[model samples]
Target chain A: MKQSLTQIHEMWERFPSVQKELQDVLFIIQDSLKANDKEVEKALLDMFRAGGKMLRPAFVIIIGQFYPGNASKLKHIAASIEMLHTATLVHDDIIDDSPERRHAPSIQSKFGKDIAAYAGDYLFAATFKTLAFHTDDMTVVRQSTKLLENILTGELTQRTNHYDRHMTLADYKEQIAGKTAALFVLSAQLGATNGDAPEEFVNLVTDFAYNVGMAFQILDDILDYQSTTKDLGKPTLQDVREGVYSAPLIIAMQNKPEIQKLLAKKESITNEEAIQLRDMVIASGAVDEATDLASEYTEKALDYLSQLPEGESKDTLVAISEALLERAN
Target chain B: MKQSLTQIHEMWERFPSVQKELQDVLFIIQDSLKANDKEVEKALLDMFRAGGKMLRPAFVIIIGQFYPGNASKLKHIAASIEMLHTATLVHDDIIDDSPERRHAPSIQSKFGKDIAAYAGDYLFAATFKTLAFHTDDMTVVRQSTKLLENILTGELTQRTNHYDRHMTLADYKEQIAGKTAALFVLSAQLGATNGDAPEEFVNLVTDFAYNVGMAFQILDDILDYQSTTKDLGKPTLQDVREGVYSAPLIIAMQNKPEIQKLLAKKESITNEEAIQLRDMVIASGAVDEATDLASEYTEKALDYLSQLPEGESKDTLVAISEALLERAN
Candidate 1:
């Protein structure tokens, strides 16, 4: 849990106001998950302490500042978003059988998959409890609940897409849009709608979040090929072994159709073959091509940010967006 | 899904009205789960079609008849209760890693654990979606969502309590109260509150549900000791293998202290040991003891039902309660 917090924490240090908001979010999550069973309670909190970028909550909190929203309510909503993200992560690790989450052994790996499933289920239920407790608006509850559906549908789609050497770049975009961006859009939308933000502004922030999420996910997919286990705080070639074709691999396969033979290994993918495939994708210059797409999405996100009225919140949003794009880990 | 339906259906034949209500619930569940991804949609439906007793929804529907609530709205809430119950069952199978459910291959066994997890998660989201879509009452949403918490908290507690040779009657009672009774209580409570039922009546129905659920779960555990795999539609003596000591075993252990040596095998318990444990439990007359306790609960449930003003619904509740208690499968 402590592994990447040092780096992610350092990034948050530059924006004390946003940092304070995120700190409150952490507390609300901790308080909300105070379970009757101490072990059940501790399982989720331990995962929370193994922090990530907190980017989703940051989006909710940062966008929350522009005619933003209710003070205490925004934090509750932000905590809800964070908790949903973590629950998906726990389930995702189980699905992928991935050993690490943010540089720590994943819940599924550290505990049994049964414990992992329960912990995730606990978080899923806690999320709704938090939202329903804090917000009377059925729209908030309904939309957030559907947000979970969208996320899982994306996952199911990707599972079908798995090991298909013909998987296209378009498929990747659609998959990630649902898989990753839906939550981001919801986070921004909830913060804006929570208070007095007008419809026009709510629409604008959702567009901004949509773009930011697209770029964020593309960057994440790229890092799988470019970053090390230490840098990513998870296995580097993990996706390849699991037969999940991300952007760089998809682009590389297109440019060099010969790579399909290696991908055709599917379940039989050997460790050495996985390493070879990684080297081949990097060698094919797909990393640079994928980065160009990420940059374009980043530019679009910045364009959305540029339209917001001038303020410290807007400036902080811009700084964070740029830092997120330029991040090494 | 079809394995035990013939038997369960024969029991339901006497109550055509409740059967009709359940049919509508099946349609609502089918309608709610129609998805963007056909496979994702089909996955849950297949599990749903794997017929269940639909007892939870029946509780909601029967209680709704007392106040005679909004027709369509009652169906939706009943659907939500059924979906929640099914979602938990899918997760339970995954946790137990059991080979069968209702005389059919479990979702985890049939679709692989990843798909099973997604299928279960999808149902959880759909359950909330059903509730939110049906009512604007945040109390309904809040309480039902917390009901999920109570159910999951019971599950988490069980994991900690697993394999404990020292498990007591008190521990078993407390565990089943949360695990089994909470949902039943919520089912009855939601239906009563859905209409104009007074606070006093709601208490009566919830108390009835609590006693019924306790008896129902105790009977289920008892069946694990006395019934054949074909009779139960699930593997017999499975809980003993999993170290889930229930009423029969707990009662039998008190009668036969020598059983402790066998239970002390714990994780290393062999197939023969599991069968031997079951035989010993049955031979010790603990099954009879467990049946006596279930009948006592059945009487308490009937007493609560008796307090309700005489009506066709009350009579139906009494009939179903007795039938459920006398059920052999």
Candidate 2:
């Protein structure tokens, strides 16, 4: 566990200055989740402590460094983004019926779905409240809200498309754009705006973040197929079991037509069947194909980063994009 | 059906000028819900067509009349409040597992819980996006977000306290303050601010709206016990069936110890037992007690309106408060 922590820490070493600031943002999140109801406070505190990569906040901090703005205010925006991300995870856990997150019993698992639902909602409200109150700029609030709209829409599309074996690559890409890329864009753009960067710089970061977000989610889908429960902190092929076919599964079906028939079946797939499907997907070279796609996105993100003025922030951004391509869990 | 429509239409007659604007807001909402996915759009459209009294938006229009600012902007804010209310109902139906709403099958019932969850979340994102983009005032956005916090927290408290027969009247009040009163306060306060009303008037309308909201919820609870399913548009004794003891049930339990014992049973109440409990609640005169309490709130709301400057809006506010007390369903 300590080695894993060290690996995670190494990923953020390029932006080491934001480490203490990120801790401050987490404390702000904890304080903001405090409700008149003690149970709500406890639930939120537990979820926060379960821990995450805090990647979204780090992105915000790293991008903000490119320009001149109040680091404290940027921290608040970063906290809001993380809380919003946390809120989505709470709901996603309920929707997925997963019993664990961050290697601990999930909020819904421990508190019941009903409480977990409200906890997710409370976090969302907290996110907006923090954005509206803490940020001096209304543009930041407005832009963040638009990003939230995209994220929820992506979620809606994904839910509607569940069990749809006919879902195409374009459809999957659109879903991930909403579910994943929207927030990345918001983080980078809002950070740039916070730093009082030029519009050209803001747009460049937005493009970079979009590609990074795409790569990040593609890698996540890949990890779901290849990583262990101990490493990914959840069971592998869980998405497929739930009838959600991510990038690799989608690409694999094109090569292995038999895989599509198995997925189309309405009944639950047995453990042996799931393993069979996993082997077929691996054998189809879909893993390699998806990896190449992720790398392509990461390359594009780096290309955008290179267009920005030379600075430590640009270097950190480039490092983060490259590191995302090589991540295993 | 015509009578019910007439009752609803009459309620909106006082604000004839804003009728077109209200329709425009609905169109904006419809446009916002349009996505690449047709299923999501259709579900949202159906839910919107299930229809509501549009009371929150009406309150915003009425309150805005008291000041002089952009009517169009106030309309946008009003739409956002209604969308927020709609979003809560979508989630609440899922939490309660309600099959029907507004005399039609609920979003969850028709589209499944997963889709309904996203639909609710989509509406919420739409609400915030509307508020952030349409209005120029950060204060309005900030205050509205705070109200949303209160609303979701109230919902959390309610969910946590489900089936607890020991739930105090104060606890119930606090829950309603968050769930019901907070939105009303937001409607009035935002409307007043949009119209450029003085801070004094804004605060006055907030107090007025808060009292109106409390009364509104008390009456809603009372109707849940007294009205037929056909009239209420859903089942009655639902609270008791679900172990959610509302106003009359709480008031009756104080007078009859047997009611407490019956409620303490963890098993689901049979149809016969629900009818019997209804009889006991009526026999205990708890209905009258709850009614008197609701009336007291309405009176306070009217008193606040009387303190405001004499205008058409004040008269309309008083009429609405009085009408709310007299509402049978």
Q: lDDT of all the models against the reference?
A: 0.84, 0.80
lDDT of 1 by residue, B32-123 (tens): 88774686566666666666788998888989988886889889999998888888989889888878887778878877888889888988
**Which residues of candidate 1, in runs, are more than 4 Å off?**
A1-8, A327-329, B1-8, B327-329
In candidate 2, how many Å is residue A188 off? 1.3
lDDT of 2 by residue, B212-276 (tens): 89999999998877877889877768767766778898899888889989877755788778878
**How does candidate 2 score on lDDT?**
0.80
Model 2: fraction of the reference interface contacts it also forms: 0.72
> How much is B168 displaced in model 1, in angstroms?
0.5
For candidate 2, the C-alpha RMSD (Å) to the true structure equals 3.6
Clashes of 1: 3
Model 2, span A53-146: residue lDDT tens: 7889888888888786987889999999999999899888988888899888888898877778778877888888898888867888878777
Please name the candidate that would achieve the greatest TM-score relative to the true structure: 1
What are the models' TM-scores? 0.96, 0.93
CAPRI docking class of candidate 2: medium
User: Which pairs of residues clash in candidate 2, taking residues 3 or more apart in a chain or in different chains?
Assistant: none
